[model samples]
Target: METPLTANIKPGRRPPDIKAYRKAGGYRALREAVLKMRPEEVTQTVKDANLKGRGGAGFDAGLKWSFVPMGEEASGPKYVAINADEMEPGTFKDRLLMEGDPHQLIEGAALAAYAIQADVAYIFLRREYHLSARLLRRAIAEAYDSGCLGQGILGSEYSLDMHLHISAGRYMSGEETGMLNAIEGRRANPRAKPPYPQVSGLWGNPTVVNNVETVCNLPHIVNNGADWFRNLSLTAEGGTKIYGASGRVRRPGTWELPMGTPLRELVEEHAGGMQQGYRLRGIIPGGASTEFLTPAHLDVKMDFVSVEAAGSRLGTGTIIVLDDHSCPVGMTLNLEQFFLRESCGWCTPCWGGLQYAVELLTGIEAGAGRMEDLDTLDSLAAMLAPGHTFCALAPGAAEPLGSALRYFREDFERHIRQQRCPWSS
Candidate 1:
């Protein structure tokens, strides 16, 4: 398959050194942007390409860059922060990119920094990604030595300083403002928008936070025209996505497939179908936070709009498969438990509501559930939906729990009536 992002990645070898990356045209986009394209021109190209954030939210990448104040009003220091804190359950695509293609990220970050005119850029990585963090640091040093980064980059007037900050591995820091707080040595709690990141972030100056995959698309978007990038997708979006799979699949890993590929193809083909003796029950189509899609939804195209049309969000492009032998109540309980533990306690709903969800899900999984628990879960999901929480944490948790209750209500009822998991036999 023609994989854009992983094209240069060779298996069983360390990530390509700076020399190899340069030979393969790694920093070409950054140099072009610094020497040829204006900041606005770069931003406009990305906008035209319709590049969406790969960090769950499908916001247009170029449109986001355009939000940063430019020229004299953008006086003081600006920043570009890479949200490399790949903390979402079942999402390891960013870690794969960072570990297997660090320079790609550096080059992409450079292009984004140039677009936003950010002198300083930060990679807020997850603490668990020690190998990736080390690889990224080495790549950044190599970039500096080659003059692809640091003062007077590519011998152009543009200069950029890049830094790496390994986080304490909190899921909250994956949120943009919370990421800003972590980078600034503050607690990893999300900040209210409106002095949004582009206007006031990273020490009260303009900043732009992009996901690792989102930034990785910049180099390609700059090298190829926007039209070409858009054509790369199987749908309306631009470029390929690093879709991943875990749990019960014969071959569980990530691949750079064209966007809008059918969910069935991803599981039955790319992931090598379910393991022997296991039948597909449902799938969290985009990580643990998205709604569960039953086998009936396997035909749905895996893209933001299509997934939404099918009653789910294509978040992170990572799917966690649920096999027939696995109890949906238990699986949902595990996910809700994670959300409960990771909550920053910023708001009443997420802090309190997630805890309530965990308790209810635990009871249901333990075969002590009441029929009323179904209604309670439904009402709780509504309460935690987007607007009710300070951040997406609770709402995200709501998706799986809510959907499990809807699509797998019989599973919950079976546990309650039988006083044991249906799969236990």
Candidate 2:
């Protein structure tokens, strides 16, 4: 495959033929797993791979699937929701799986459906991703026509039906529960947990929801074997991720790279270094939601565990560089505005706390904030979490804010004490 853990083909192109997929030994594992191997074997392969979710949570993919009740419990009409809502600020890696190697995603989705014994499946796509939606729909249709998605696949009595649903362009819909609600034609608010999607979802049946990137990795694991998949990354982290870097970079674009690729190598080599005019100051290592990483942290490995060790996540593997000219406070405020506006308003803390945060941040950005507001913002973030009304939205909202205060305290102080933002203003 490619440098990244994932095999990315050119955009909007399918493999030349099913024969091509066959030549690559694609769908062979599906046939083997269905006709010869059992669903338990399939799940065990993924578990052995130690595959982590490419979504923000980084939940172990095998563990999440294991949540599905098996044996007689895995009876008919179960569902697996493919999360294609790639709305995280710096996250667009899933778009590659959708656009480039659609068949890989289809095969992967089929594997998960088989493993979970899902009778039907849905690919919940972001509304703004009209192109991806169209491409996936076409791929789904192709799978059905090719007998890959329909009943008794390769002579096994496993019948599966799949469909695609588009989401309205709202950030909240990316949350797993929210995606389920939206799929059911609800108003897209998060459902209360304890009854997580694995228990009651999509018409009150047990469901398995996985990110697009996570599912796309399945076919490779099945086709190439789990150890090969595990060894894809030189480090223990294994597998490939589509890495994207923007802002102040000479060549700002996405490349499918190995998981343990050093952040410095990505910026300095793959990304062609920072642009000539803007010297690199610090970076919002993932998307804007992640904490900023100073140049001192460049040598850190850019994998989930390593990035987390460096005080940020390998979230969606999107690296947003901040140049010396960019004001950290202004950039952080901009991100806060996004979170504040996108709150689902299902919970009191997020609804009110985020609004209060905006006020405090705006005051600081506009030179009206007092030093005390910094303390207040931190306290507000603490109160807004685990205390929130909805899903991960509010807690995810606090991540960057809390991290910014911790890492870039001086920048926040500059905004407040100097009575002005150090950036353009």
Candidate 3:
């Protein structure tokens, strides 16, 4: 219930200006990191706090920061890139944060840049977020004018220049490496790993791409010690998470809850339960990319490990509920269509495979599917799994369809047997 991240956000309102934000202790962490703490010290503090990335991938943020090589042998002109391309379906948490508290992000970016010893930072914001972009621009300018950013921040020798780059608006750009390519004015395709962004990124230098929410925790971790930060969570991880819900929920909104809050609590308590005349059926536990969780698994904790254990993921903490009246096949088909359209067309599996999935799911949704189609769907999903693709795009695209086939097989069969949507009647 201690909503650290959403504390400054007011419903249906723009963020307070720079002076007000400073009054609320906004830039203190940035100043502390730059003036009082060493780069390694800042990173170590975050590491000790067990801070994890909130950008779908639950990677350890501190570990990511520590991966950037240091000393003479390390690469020069390292960069810190903020992943603000919030395009994931059912995920509006980052957009809300950006729109309501742009200064929080700016302060977070400055602290992150200082932690990584990067003089330059870029916030790769989505083009659709015009208001968020304007707010960020104003916040950055205010930071510079107030001496919290640019040339000797807070009278310290350290300096960080922040740049806001509006993306061309591709879903693939949400991928860390793909975001880097987009920032470089190239096609928004995911790059091969092994020499990850931490080693060579953004103009071919050591870079760290952090989510908007992930870095926002930096100031808190610094101001209150690692122990305080760690205790914020009820689970093994540190800090509260912004959990969002949509679809048939009566009160569909985002809430800053403990990291391991129950999926049932999120839906029933936070979302005000399903709408009248709608019974809970299934849930896309994370974003559209995550596997579906049936009512049997509603008690599952909404954390990375627990959700994964339930054959889904806690991606971005955004839940899209499925009502009993809704046809699962149609739902999956809609998601597959999104994947198909968003594919960068770089690889066969993702580009071609997603198209194939779209075709198969569309046919099934339209009552033209056969019994063999289920097997074909399973095969296609396997082909898109982790090692079979260039990036997580294909793997993620496969999750919903694959799981829908498993949990809602009877629904698919009903559609096929009846030669029409079962839920239509």
**lDDT values of the candidates?**
0.90, 0.81, 0.89
lDDT of 3 by residue, 297-333 (tens): 9899988888998889999999999998888888998
Candidates 1 and 2 compared: the better one by lDDT is 1
35-126 per-residue lDDT for model 2 (tens digits)? 87788888899988888888867888888888877887554479989998888997778887677766777788889988888888888888
- Per-residue lDDT for 283-388 in model 1, tens only? 9988878999999999999999999999999999999999988888889988999999999999998988888888888887777888898888899998888998
User: How well does model 1 score by local distance difference test?
Assistant: 0.90
Clashing pairs in 3: none
Instruction: Work out the TM-score per prediction.
Output: 0.98, 0.94, 0.98
lDDT of model 1 at position 406: 92
What lDDT score goes with residue 203 in model 3? 87
Better model by lDDT: candidate 2 vs candidate 3: 3
Task: For model 2, name the residue pairs that clash.
Answer: 4-240, 4-257, 5-239, 5-240, 5-241
Residue 386 in model 3: lDDT: 85
> By TM-score, is 2 or 3 better?
3
Worst 10 residues of 3 by lDDT: 69-78
Query: What CA RMSD would candidate 2 show?
Result: 2.0
